[model samples]
Target: MDGYTTALVCAAAAAGAALVRSGKRYIDNSAVELLAAPDGVRAMIEAHCPSLVAPARARLVPPPYLPTGMLQTIYGAMVALRRDSESDIEYDRQLRTMEDGGTVSLDWFPARPSGPECAQPIAIVMSGLGGSAYEYHIRCLAKHLATKSRAGMRVAVLNYRGSGRTPLTSSTMYNGYDTSDIYDTVGYLAQSFPRAPLVCVGFSMGANLLARYLGETGDKSRIAACVTVSCPFSGETAGRAINAPGLLFDKFFQPALTGTIKRIVKRNQDIIQSGAITYDIDAIMRAKRVCDVDNALTARAYGFKDCWEYYAACSSTDFIERIRCPFLAINALDDPIALPEGLPMDQIAKNPRAAIALVAHGGHIGFFSGLSARMWHLQPVLEFLDAVLADKAE
Candidate 1:
């Protein structure tokens, strides 16, 4: 089947899955509907994470024009764009130079005064595509996890090279395919806090990267547990879904993403001009779609023959089954960007170490619920992390 047809089938299947559940709500007023197979992971979640089993119901008020999945996805992004940063949350920046001379910024949120220090649980936050510490979701997750009354966890945000105002020292820039930077960062965290039970939470593109990292590292992974939100499991399906005609989801996202890519390029234009990174600079700057930029730049930079090759090779779908660490993937079936067709449901079900929470509606990273329109996904995340930490402690 063609890409578009495949995406439609996936969407239909997701819709069918949502309806097949027993007519029961876990919690009053909760819009979240969990679709997970019966497994040890699910049992752990049920036993430890009570909030997820019976979360308080919250209302989602989507604007008039933003009704369907396509528009809801855009609306989700718009919400993130409009949110103001938390004033009370601050960071202590630590710049670490990678082996290749590229630099990544690890923004560590201040330690909790009331929380344990000697063996405090550590949570790392990874940003989405073109994301930084400035992104609302990243800040929200970091702050939420670090709350003394809540998780009381030590939190850090990993900003890729050239992101979070980190200078790009090497010719190579960051891409979803390469997990070396994450490998380096994780190594640093493991070494610095040897006794801490390390956990990671990644959103969108970062989620995909985290999944790939977990799968690749397998049993060697130092991370005790992980949660990925809105990950694009199959890049091929996701690319096709976003670029699908008539949906206009691509029309909304492509230009915006390309703009971000262009700005990043321009910031490190000197490195590109040095003839080190072999790509058509003008073509990249003129990219009208996300695919265009990927074809012109990302695919080449990563040594892939083309973007399609890169998409297939880098997609986390192939790696999900190999993941050894306890992992949870949180997704919205209606997310226009991360199409449900790509979710490795079969693989996840087979992997005893993995579980998935497929909500009927959460839009990419925008799981906004409640009358106040706050991020509702944070609750499940906190519950999951808290559960993992507790299980480890015992």
Candidate 2:
């Protein structure tokens, strides 16, 4: 073919591919129609993600604490998802004595091997900031989802470096987490379960990591697909949004991180007494805030200049268009953590390789829609993952 003809064909293909990558579901108010909650839940979520309270038949769900059929079972897990204790705290444990810089032990759910003929895909779950494998009802969801299908999936929860056993090799972590860790873990799993399909899901902080992985890695991904729930694509906007005064976010999260870090620091009094580092443990915790935490910690602990440099280097916004795999990112405008400014839903919708699922609610890592405030943890999350993976075979 002539150069002109060849160029035209290439343009057409490119346009078509872009179209395929566009928004997963037609957004706007219609998206929130699926949430099942009281008027208060809608209002709460809307306060964070306004688009989360759309007019879906989803409201038909029964209220929490009430006894219903299968829905009750799911609600039980939701309650569990919301509950927390000292163990769930991220950075508060006493750490001066612990050798691993107060890092928690690594935790993971067991996975059954996925032999051939099984369409059921295994799901790898990534938890949010200061969150453990137990924090967000993930355990409940994993257990519950396993019961539904024939060849049940293996649900593996990713505890960030310091959150669990994988303590920080560095002092503090960054906003855009180390995607390489997740990629490596998933790679290890794929090799172990060659016949089984693998799917990945992340929430809030975890979601950002997943999105980064999607955008950064070229089209040749080993995992089947990914779901990013409540992730902020643009670091600056999200940082600004969460940092905004009067939202109660800093108040809600800072103490959690501070408290955790203090506990760890106190535990390792010997390390402090010996002057392993210049600053005291409490001083380190005091330096952390929603916006400043990543920088404060990284600089003091891991030795980065500031958070901006770290965010710029790690943020996934630059990698969006290069992703070749099929993935779905769920967002809610009302979510306090992930705002919709430079989120670029239009760009996502235009890309055929993506399924940009947007909602108006499910605050940060708190997407309990269609779930009750009872039970142990979030149950339906596994179902959502299951449904998404099952679709892959069809």
**RMSD of each candidate?**
9.6, 16.8
lDDT of 2 by residue, 1-394 (tens): 9999999999999998877664222222224333222332223233322232335422223233332322332333345445454123222122211333433332434444435444446777776665667654555545555555444765667666556545454443423556666666667667766777877777767877887777766666777766676677777676666556653445654665556555554554455445344544455556656445555444444355776656555566666666665555665555565666756565554555554544444445544333333321233344345444555656
**What's the C-alpha lDDT at position 187 in model 2?**
72
| Position 217, candidate 2: lDDT | 66
Question: How far off is residue 283 in model 1, in Å?
Answer: 0.8
- The TM-scores of all predictions, comma-separated, are 0.85, 0.65
Q: lDDT winner among the candidates?
A: 1
What is candidate 1's CA lDDT for residue 57?
35
TM-score (C-alpha) between model 1 and the true structure: 0.85
